[model samples]
Target: MDIAATVIAIEFRLPGPININTAPAERLQELPGIGPALAARIVAFREEHGPFDTIEDLTHVPGIGPRTLDAVRDLITVVDER
Candidate 1:
């Protein structure tokens, strides 16, 4: 067996209580159904529009819908402005 073939892939998990309005694309990718492109779109949408008021507001983002919202709802939150 080749030594290189023995390499193992490791998965890195992000710490939870992730703030969707403020998390970087990388961290956002850890959500249930979100990937790199969707994560970037979320950030772009947030920047172009504004912060999300409620988790359901995520459906306003182009690719996200009610299903995706339901999947990630528990994993994300909008940080309140104080």
Candidate 2:
């Protein structure tokens, strides 16, 4: 009798571009440079000021500078709640 081994592979994918307007800090942390603290700051900024008008507006968030924004720009998006 002979035994055979089988290997399984799994692939992971993001649902789509993260919606900055609605994504929570946990979700925001998925970005390349965003960590827990930065993610929370983003959420706080959004909550305090309102949803971002554009991806570029993320620069307004403390700790989120141009470099961080550039890293995540292609991966994030802003959606209109209204």
Candidate 3:
């Protein structure tokens, strides 16, 4: 059925991509799993650390994980030079 097909399409499609390295807390919440607490933590970590080295490095921050990183991997990038 058309409805079933639509659901299938949605299920097969990938979630939105997020940029973790520089996204603001509000923006971070747009991702799949992040909430205000995590978003605030991310901002604080960014402020304290200056900038992130890599997407994987987000896990090293106070409140992130592999799943969280996976959600925003495409959208986040380290813009500044090390």
lDDT of each: 0.85, 0.84, 0.74
Global lDDT for candidate 1? Answer: 0.85
Better of 1 and 2 by TM-score: 2
Query: lDDT tens string, model 1, 1-82?
Result: 5555444322123345679899999999988889999999999999999999888889999899989998888888897433
lDDT of 2 by residue, 1-82 (tens): 2232222221123356889989989999999999999999999999999999999999998888889988998888897433
The pairs that clash in candidate 1 are none
Candidates sorted by TM-score, best first? 2, 1, 3
In Å, residue 40's CA in model 1 sits off its true spot by 0.6
After the best TM-score superposition of candidate 3, give how far the Cα of residue 6 lies from its true spot, in angstroms. Answer: 22
TM-score of each model, in listed order: 0.76, 0.79, 0.63
Tens digit of lDDT per residue, candidate 3, span 1-82?
6999988888667544445666788988886677899889888987888777777888877667777777767766665432
All models, RMSD in angstroms: 7.6, 6.6, 6.7
After the best TM-score superposition of candidate 3, give how far the Cα of residue 5 lies from its true spot, in angstroms: 28
Where model 2 places Cα greater than 4 Å from the true spot, the runs are 1-12, 80-82
Better of 1 and 3 by lDDT: 1
